[model samples]
Target: MEFIFLAAGLIMGLGAIGAAIGVGLLGSKLLESTARQPELGPMLQTKFFIVAGLIDAIPIIGVGIAMYLIFVVAA
Candidate 1:
């Protein structure tokens, strides 16, 4: 039972860390690309937002699974 909690915590922690790194890199690359071509800035910004949402989904799914482990599986 205790291990279940540990597993859930690990899941959430790692998921958040991975997502943070992904978004950070994504933002940096976006900035770099926009700096290279100002005319494409708007189009790049649009694609950046779309990719960011997909990156964020990973952590959200992790949270859902963690919650299930804590509330349902551990119960």
Candidate 2:
């Protein structure tokens, strides 16, 4: 039904917004820390990448599900 497509769009949109906010805040803090501690830049960057992956995981899954719902289920 049309509702299914709407639900999929909401899921994808909300997930993207949440992920964007989380990553933006996290990266901002990480940059601030790196600026304060230049010597630890490498270590901070490594951890930032790890955390970025974790933060992105859920939204990526939501995108996949949304694609499935929009293309397969709704079709």
Candidate 3:
């Protein structure tokens, strides 16, 4: 039972860390690209938001799975 909690924690923690790193790198590249081509800033911003949402979905899914483990499996 305790191990189930640990597993869920690990899943959520790692998922969050992975998403953070991905978004950080994505933002860094977006800034670099926009700086290099200011005229394309708007287009780059649009793409960045789309990709950011996709990146964020990873952690949201992780949270849902974690909840399932804690409530359904552990219970």
- lDDT for model 2 comes to 0.92
Ranking of predictions according to lDDT:
3, 1, 2
> Cα miss at 61, model 2 (Å)?
0.4
User: Residue 16 in model 2: shift from native, Å?
Assistant: 0.8
Top candidate by lDDT: 3
Question: What CA RMSD would candidate 2 show?
Answer: 1.5
Query: What's model 1's lDDT at 3?
Result: 99
Taking the tens digit of each residue's C-alpha lDDT, what string does model 1 give over 4-75?
A: 999999999999999999999999999999999999999999999999999999999999999999999999
lDDT of 3 by residue, 1-75 (tens): 999999999999999999999999999999999999999999999999999999999999999999999999999
Query: What TM-score, computed on C-alpha atoms, does each candidate reach?
Result: 0.98, 0.85, 0.98
Candidate 1 stretches greater than 4 Å from native: none
Report the C-alpha displacement of residue 54, candidate 1, in angstroms: 0.4
Report lDDT per candidate.
0.97, 0.92, 0.98
Reference-based TM-score, model 2:
0.85
How do the residues 1-75 of candidate 2 rate in per-residue lDDT, one tens digit apiece?
Answer: 899889998998999899999999999999999999999999999999999999899889998999899899988
Question: Which of 2 and 3 is ahead in TM-score?
Answer: 3
Candidate 3 error regions (>4 Å): none
